[model samples]
Target chain A: EAEVAQSPRYKITEKSQAVAFWCDPISGHATLYWYRQILGQGPELLVQFQDESVVDDSQLPKDRFSAERLKGVDSTLKIQPAELGDSAMYLCASRPPGSGIGTGELFFGEGSRLTVL
Target chain B: SQKIEQNSEALNIQEGKTATLTCNYTNYSPAYLQWYRQDPGRGPVFLLLIRENEKEKRKERLKVTFDTTLKQSLFHITASQPADSATYLCALDKGSGNTPLVFGKGTRLSVIA
Candidate 1:
């Protein structure tokens, strides 16, 4: 079965340092998403990509956060000058396009947990 | 602002009993509602999807009911077992083709044997 893959299951960084998380979505999926999940809260959309172009990033903290899906298959989310408040679980998910007998369904990865102190 | 609410507290149920979880939303209509299960320190796994036009959907020992008028969805697990203990989340699609889903905080269930 195809599954989204994420790396650095756990990451610890110092404040003002840089951290990056990578995700390889399910093969052939056209849509990818990055979400931030704070403890005791639901996952919040941080960025979304359709193919190689960003579809939505309204919730992303542009000042310090950035994400890229260069070849439209794998993606990376980076945080320059990480802050303590950035500690949380970053999740990646993907889905195919269109609907029908195989209406696209979203699949998630184990996620990368980050801690900045 | 749109919001999804699930019980923040844990729910305890005995094995072999039925476990019912509620999800309520405020503001905005969802194209479809989905249920997912997550074990500790792991990601969510999709379980079922119920569309606004559909009243109910079922699979195996799980059942999902959606009430568009009430802006709510209920997930039920029958013949619950200890293995069924986990956090269950409810998510909603924003209606945009490429938009990501909005997730609820999730309710934790503990099935005691």
Candidate 2:
């Protein structure tokens, strides 16, 4: 029962500050994803990485948000000059290599909570 | 554009009863649909996945049915308990290579003992 690992379960910051969250996907997983979940809302994908390469990031607000998986194993997501609306849960998920190309269960981390005031 | 709609904002069920959640979609055909459960302040945990070619799938007390023609999927939990209370989300992946799942807002269920 390997799981995706996330750090700083909770974080509190002020607007205009920078915040970062780290995640380690399940071992042997090749696909990693970062999603944002607003209160009482479904999680939305922000970016997706296949190994060390980014496959999709059309939804990410590049002006203030950036994400990277330097070694294609662990990943980091950062938001600079945080806004009040940016307060939400950041979720990390991973898919194993043999999961049949997006048709399998996703292992999710407990998530990192961000509260911007 | 694709849209997924679940049940009402919330559902109230008694313990030892069956709880059925609905997930309907429009504007796109999905190759597979998945259900996940989320407790308060936590991430979603996968429950089950049903493929378009499959009519029904079951796991212990949990059952799922997919209707490709109607573009809908149904999730069921039998003899549910108070511990079953949470928000249930339904997501879909079109089966394209490397495509991501699109999630719905989710329906909250409260099982009373």
Candidate 3:
């Protein structure tokens, strides 16, 4: 079974520093997602990408956070000047094309955990 | 404001018993509902999905039911074991094109052996 891959499984940085996480979705997957999950809470969508194009980013804090799927295969999420409240798990997911439109099941990576001091 | 609620934050059940978790949504009608399992410090893994038109779906010892009229979904695990202990999440999608799934906080289950 093909699986999504994520790097930097754990990261720790001080407030006001920079942090980045990377994800590589399953091959042939056209849609990719980046979500932030706070402790004790559900995951929140930060960005969505469709074939290297952004589909949704309304929930993303553009002022400090940015994400890109340059090749539509792997993606990177960055946060400049991280805040203490930004500590959480950064998850990456992918869906194959024509799977179920908006109803397809997502395959998630192991995730990148971030801690801001 | 759309909201998703799970029945409780934590549940305890004995081994070989059935564990039931509840998910309720308000202010939105979803076309499909999904269940996921998450271990501590890990990302969620999809378990089951039930469509609005479908009443129930099952996979081995796992079962899920979607009720659009009641705006609720029920997730059940039968003959549970200690390995089944984890946080279970319920996610909903509006069924529109290119929409993202909304998730609930999740319910933590501890299946004691």
Candidate 4:
């Protein structure tokens, strides 16, 4: 089974620094999502992309966070000047479906864990 | 505004028994609901999804029931094992096109052998 891929399974950084996490979705998937999971909490959507175009980013804190999928295949999420609250598990997910982006299930990556001190 | 709520408390169950978790919502109607499992320090893995028009959906030992009138969904794992231990989350996507999903805090399950 094809799986979503994420890099740097664990990352430790000091506050005020910059960090980036990468993700490669399943080969044929057209939609990708980035989520942040706080300790003992559910995953929160950070950004979503539909074939190189942003579908939703209302929840992302644009001042310090940015995400991009330049070619619509792989994506990267960046946090500049990280804050203590930035410590969390960052997950990447892909949506695969026969139709265009209305409704479908998502497959998630193992996630990149960030620890900011 | 819509809200999803799952039990924040940890549920302890014995091996070979059934473990049931609850998810409730308010303020909006969803076209479908989904359940996911997450181990500590990991991302959520999709378990099952049930549509509002469907009353129930099952996959092997896992079963899910959606009650749109009640605005709640129930997840059940039968003959669970220690490996089944994890946090279970319930999510819903608002009906609007391209809208993102909303997730509950999740309920932690601990299956003791």
lDDT of 4 by residue, B16-109 (tens): 9999999999997888788999888778888888888889999999999999889989999999999999999999965455556688999999
Displacement of residue A98 (Cα, Å) in model 2 is 2.2
Candidate 3 lDDT tens digits, B11-65? 9999999999999999998888989999999889999988899999999999999
CAPRI quality of model 3: medium
DockQ sort, best first:
2, 3, 4, 1
> Which residue pairs show collisions in model 2?
none
Task: Name model 3 segments beyond 4 Å from true.
Answer: A101-103
Clashing pairs in 4: none
lDDT of 2 by residue, B1-113 (tens): 77899977799999999999999999978888999999998889999988888999999989999998888899999999999999999999887776788999999999999
Error of 2 at B4 (Å): 0.9
- lDDT digits (tens) for residues A35-80 of candidate 1: 9988767789999999899989999999999999999999999999
The positional error of residue B59 in candidate 1, measured at the CA in angstroms, is 0.6
Pick by lDDT: 2 or 3, better one = 3
Off by over 4 Å in 2: none
Write down the lDDT that model 2 would get: 0.92
User: What are the lDDT scores of the predictions, listed in order?
Assistant: 0.90, 0.92, 0.93, 0.89
Compute the lDDT of residue B97 as modeled in candidate 3.
68
* Global Cα lDDT for candidate 4: 0.89
Candidate 2, after superposition: displacement of residue A80 in Å? 0.5
Give the per-residue lDDT of model 3 (tens digit) for A2-47. Answer: 9999999999999999999999999999989999999999999999
